[model samples]
Target: MSKITRIKGFADYFPPESEAFTFMENAARDVFSRYGYRELRTPVLEKTELFARSIGEETDVVKKEMYTFPDRKDRSLTLRPEATAGVMRSYIESGLATREPYSKLFTFGPMFRYERPQKGRMRQFHQINAECLGLTEPAVDAEVVAMLWQFLSSIRIPNLSLEINTLGCRECRPAYNEALKAYLDSVPEDGWCEDCLRRKSTNPLRVLDCKVPGCKALVDDAPALVDSVCEECSDHFGQVLAHLDAIEIPYTVNKRLVRGLDYYNRTTFEVTSGEIGSQSAVAGGGRYDGLIRDLGGPDQPGIGFACGMERLLLLLPEEEAPRPDAYLAILDEAGMARGFLILQAMRARGVIAEMSPTPKSVKAMMRQANRLRSRFCLLMGPDEIARDVVQVKNLDSGDQNDFSVTSESDLDALADFLR
Candidate 1:
């Protein structure tokens, strides 16, 4: 028989690691809720066209990274590679825009993408996503950034930096696109990767986002989008920066920081930390005013961000193992019945308690108690039960004492002793 193993790019979180993830998630939820955002959940699968439509047909997410398949009845579906598209689809289908003027929503769960697994990336990844739909105010963008900043700070991630950029809207991006395309045409194709060559004719702006060194160097002299944005876009971006400044959020404007998505426009930002090596982008998002309308919804504007849980987990401080309040060790059949009663009573009092799964010698039980790091151990044997008493050992201080009880009925007395 062959041994079973986990699939590649997927992770298993055990004990203290799982506890650390829970702590981060709770912190995120607390921060998000404080700003009047409600939790929203959507299915992991959506129609194949949803991503293709929202994340640009030419982007890598749709071209090569999506996990798509045809379900029964010949309908094509894809496991969600990101949450923003699905959340927008739900907003449109649920007619949420009509019911409310603004929607502040958040969700956290698994997202699937078929990409070469690296140190902080996986086929199965999780994100804490926050979105504000039906609002076009620049202040909303600043608020989103502030909430995420507070969340990372609360979790104690070190050496943080925020990068901000603006991809001018459809109204002004064409001029920059033409200038960028001409520059791409001048560069010899021999130095470019196959993807960059294809993008030069297709979505040429994406060529700026390629990570290949030769490809990156070729675009070093390419045109900047900030210089090409129209007055309206420039003002909008200026207001976003102004708001960040008012709140004392430090940021650097990187001309080449194009996020790996097609829906972004006018204002894009990323939060990065040096702790994660190379892949330092811990959270990223921008305003997507056209995404709602493109997905067959109204012309509602939206702004949001998604933080990778796996990446943030890499920066979290190690957590200490939790200690149990008491361990019950029973010797002899008569003491077993009384042990059950005391265990229940201790638990009812909000004390963490456990018993050995099987009967064992005193030495073995003590070893188990030590391993559990239980504060105290309650021992019941034939002689102790006959005397209507139980021996309690303080595992931490190495102190021993005998406490009297009325056989199996003195739960109050046992609870008082443990407390």
Candidate 2:
């Protein structure tokens, strides 16, 4: 028989790496909660139409990356490639906007995308997502960006910077798109990548986001969308920048910072770090005032962002696995029975205690305890069990002490001392 292995692009997390993930999650909950953002968990699978509508059918995510398929009943379903669409679907289906005019939500979970795996990109990746719904004010955009900045800062990700741009709203975007399309059409087809060439017709703005060197160079002299935004969009963006300044959040206005999503409009922002190689963007998002309405929900406005958990992990320092506080060594049959009771007592009192299932020589048990990096080594034998006591060695300081276990109160005292 052959040994089974995990599917390619699907990663298995273990200690240290897993611990770093948890630390990032806990930091998200802490920072987001401070800004009145509550958690909302949605299923990883959803009707394929949800994404096709919310993320735009022409986007690369829908056209090439989604893990989409039909089920037994022949219904199209997809492993979500991103989170905002699902969150919007939930907000509409649950009618959450009706109850709370302003809904701030956050979620952390695995997201699937059928793309080539890289240092910080994977087929099955995780994201820490946040959404602020109902308010359309420029201040809302600024607040969302600020909250994201603070969360990333709290985790101490080094060498981070913020880049923001405005992709004019519907009323003004058509004119800029025409201008951008004209510029793209004039450029020789040989200068653009295949995707850029297709986008020149399907979605011209996406050409600015292409990572291909030829495409990037071609867009160097292209019309700047920010320069052509209508007064309303220009003012909205101005206010967003003003608010960010008021809060002391530094940002650079990147004319080409069009995020890889269709739902975004107006304010778009990204947080990047030099530490994560070519995939430098650790987090990004923007304002989507029309997403809710497009998803068959109320005319609610939303601003949110998502952190690629894998990318953020690349910036985090390696973490150590947790260690047991105490390891119990039972030297004989009698010690095994009494040692089990003591272990239970110690655990009941909130001590991180562990014991072997069966008895072993003291030398072997002590070696095991040292291997676990336990702070204390507890020893029990027939003599100690008969005397109603156990010896505890402080592994760190090389000190030893005996604690009486003749009564429950004594056990509590022993637990207190160990703790």
Candidate 3:
């Protein structure tokens, strides 16, 4: 017999840890809804070609990290490595464009990537995704970034720093790519890492994102993308910054922050927190003005961000699980029958009540109630049943009172008494 264990890169949230996940989901729902974003859910698996087409075959996610395989019918399906692609697919498949001009949406669930597992990074991870579609205004870009900041603040996440960058649109990115390529070609081959060497020819922009210290040193003085952006891109980037300033959102413009996706163009931003170790970015997103059309959807502008849940969980303060209002203890068969009816009636009245499942000693039931941190224990014994009342004991205060349980009026009085 072998002992069962969880897979290395997956997580099993338990007890207080699960509580933290709930807190994040609830908080995200509240904040997203307040900003007029409705919740959307899509399938965990998608067509493999979707990634190769939208995320780019040259990128790391499609080329090296996606969890892709052929199903029984000989069609390729993949566990989603990221979310935006799937959302676009759904929008197109559902004919949402004919129905609505734009959609403000948010979704959160598991995402898979076959990368090495590290602290705050996982092969199977979770993300809180928010997107605003059909709008290309620079002000929307600023609003999306501000919404992300507000969410982090609402969760009590600490020490966050905002990094913003502009990846020139189709009109200007080609020249910047050529300039970047020229610089990479001028550098000695010895300084480049194996990944950078490949990306140099395939996707020259990715060379700037390499983490190898030697590779980074070689690209240190490469031409900044911001400098190569055309007039429209420059003006849009400037307005994004101005809007951030108008709202008092502090930021640093990072010239080297080319996000790890091929779909992004103009206005890329990341929010990093000091608490999450070297995997510092808790949230990131950018404008993908061309992706909806690229993915066979209506041509519309979209901007969004995703927060890493495991990383955010690391920084969230421990939250106490809520306690039940009352526990019903049944002492004998006669009392059990009466208590069952009372339990349902109490619940119908919106009282959070539970009963001992089986016949147990009064002392054992009391202990169980205490373990659950219930506020009160309703004791139903032979004497209490004959008297048509219950012994209500306040577990915290150790005070006891007799409450009538004979009729609906009595139950209403009991409910009022408890309140």
Candidate 4:
């Protein structure tokens, strides 16, 4: 028989890394809630059409990366490659907008994509997403970006910078697309990457987002979408920048910062870190005014962002695991019985308490307690049990005291002392 191993590109998180995951999640909940956002959990699996219709069918995510399969009844299902599509599906199906026109929702969970794995990129990764629905105002865009900025800052992700761009609304985008496509066509085909070659005819905007060195160099002199937007889009983006400025959020207007999503329009933004190499973007999003209606719901506007947890984790400083408040060491059967009761009492009183499950020599138990990094150690043995008391040792100060365990009141006093 062979031992089973984890699938490639899937990872197992342990102590410190898992703790960091929790820390980031708690920070997201805290900062997002301050901005009137509530949690919304959607399933990881959805109809394949949900993504194909929401995220553009020509996009790389749909063309190459999705983990799609068929169920017993032959209906296609896909493990979500990103969160926004599922969120939109849920919003439309649940009539969320009818209930609360201005709904701000956040969610944190795993997303699956079948792509080449690299540092900070995995097949099964996690994301922290927030969506602001039912508003089309530029100020709302600014506010959503600000909230995302605050959440990342609160978690202390290092070397952060903000870059923003506008993809232009449907009315003005076609012109820019044609202009960009003409520029791409003039460039010799030999210089473009395979994907860019296909994209030039399919979706020209994605060429600017191409990371290939040759493709990037070719698009260097390409027309800027920001320079081509209509008056309304220009005004909308200007206001978004103004609001960010009013709130003291610094940003750079990168004309080439078109995010890799088809639904975005008007105001798109991304936050990158210098600490992470090449794939530096830790978070990005923008206004998607047409997604709600596209997903078969009433026409509503939305803006949101998603932070890649794996990428953000790369920027997080090393953290230590939490220490236990107390560890109970029992030296004999009698001590084991009493220590178990005391452990329960201490836990009931909110102390982070743990006890040895079986009898062990005092030295062995004490070593186990030390390994746990407990702040204090409670020792009980035949002698101590006979006296109806437990010896409490402050692991930090090397001080010892005896607490009675003969009565319920004694147990209360013992717990109080531990607290």
lDDT of 1 by residue, 1-419 (tens): 99999999888989787888789889988988999999999999999999999998989899998999998889999999999999999999999999999999999899998888998899999999999998877888888899989999999988999999989998898888999999999999899999999999988989998989899999889889988899998988899899999999999999988878889998899999998778999999999999999999999999999999989988988767879989999986667877787678679877789998666899999999999889899898888878877789999888999887765446666676677
Where is the poorest 10-residue window by lDDT in model 2?
314-323
Can you write out model 4's per-residue Cα lDDT over 15-87, one digit (the tens) per residue? 7889899999999999999999999999999999999999999999999999999999999999999999999
Model 1 CA RMSD to the hidden true structure, in angstroms: 2.2
- Candidate 2 collision pairs: none
The segments of candidate 2 whose C-alpha lies over 4 angstroms from its true place after superposition are none
**For every model in order, what is the number of clashing pairs?**
0, 0, 0, 0
Off by over 4 Å in 1: 383-390, 401-419
Candidate 3 clash pair list: none
What overall lDDT goes with each candidate model? 0.90, 0.92, 0.91, 0.91
**lDDT (10s digit) by residue, model 3, range 188-296:** 8878999999999999999998878898888879999998999999999999999999999999999999889899999999999988667799999999999989988
User: What TM-score would candidate 3 get against the native?
Assistant: 0.95
The whole-model C-alpha lDDT of candidate 3 against the native structure comes to 0.91
Q: In candidate 2, what are the lDDT values of residues 17-122, reduced to their tens digit?
A: 8889999999999999999999999999999999999999999999999999999999999999999999999999998988987999999999999888888888
Winning candidate number (lDDT): 2
